[model samples]
Target: MQLVDFFTLLFMLMGVVSAVLVAFHPNVLYAAVALVFSLLSVAGLYGVLGADFLAAVQLIIYVGGIIVVILFAIMMSENIYRARFRDAAGKFVIPTAVAALLIAGFLKLFHDAKLETRAGLNAIPTTEQMGRALVGPYALVFQYVAIVLLAGLIGAVVVARPHHGNPESEAEKK
Candidate 1:
């Protein structure tokens, strides 16, 4: 097999194994670490597929931003570290059945679909094209997304700030 194919398989395996670990691990901290590995492997798969922009976004948004936030939240909550989570008996049966059904349906769809294969298509750099598109035709949409993100950030800050307006809280502080 080619190097790219080998890397693709490796990333696929890593992603699957890590995802399983994330789902089944008893320790929440270990599960969180496994989640990181799973996300990173997905980013690697995106890179292997020549979707450089998607890979970067996956690394930046999911791995960097979301994971960091998750880790921070986990670390900040003292009760989570002391808590032992246990699943009820037979809890996995329904979800497992649903997942199996979905997998079977997807497999049937793939088997029935007539997919067109294009040959000799080069992996072009999408960063420049995306940048131009963001600033050119899709500028408004891009600006809207930025504005929404900024608003969310401001809202989060507002919500997280200490509410010192209550007389009870002020008395407790004194």
Candidate 2:
């Protein structure tokens, strides 16, 4: 196969490994690190697929911002790491077998499905075309998305603040 294909395969393998570690690892901190690695590899795969802007957004939003917040939250949590309280890890046999069967069934269904050909529409999508679509036609939608992000930021602050001295706690004191 071509070099790009080889890189794509390697990146996909890394993502799979990271996902397994994230899901099965016992240590929550290590799992968070694996999750970050998985997100980074996904961003790389987006770059390999020629989604330049998507890759940047993935790196910035997922790897740079969300994962950091996740890791910090994991670190700040006071009671999650006690070994005595950690539940016994469950056996994986039945759930894994079911998941494998479901995946195989989905693959079979996808193989049997056929796409219907439709009338011609313009298919070329370069950066300039994407820019025109985003700004010229979808500017309002983009602004709405920005507003949503701002609301998310405000919500994060509201949720993360220490509420120890709030009126509810004061009422409990009385």
Every model's TM-score? 0.77, 0.68
* Candidate 1 lDDT by residue in tens digits, 46-103: 7877779999999999988999988898888786755444544468789789999999
Q: Which candidate leads in lDDT?
A: 1
Look at candidate 2 and tell me the lDDT of residue 3: 74
Candidate 2: count of backbone clashes, pairs at least 3 residues apart or interchain: 0
Clashes of 1: 0
Which TM-score value belongs to model 2? Answer: 0.68
Pairs of residues at least 3 apart in sequence or in different chains that clash in candidate 2: none
Candidate 2 on 1-174: residue-level lDDT in tens?
A: 777678788889999999999877877888889999899889888767666678888999998999999988988987656632136546666877998999999999988988332213232345677788899899999999999989999999989765776998667767
What's the true lDDT of residue 122 in model 2? 31
List ranges where model 1 is wrong by over 4 Å: 79-85, 97-121, 162-164, 168-174
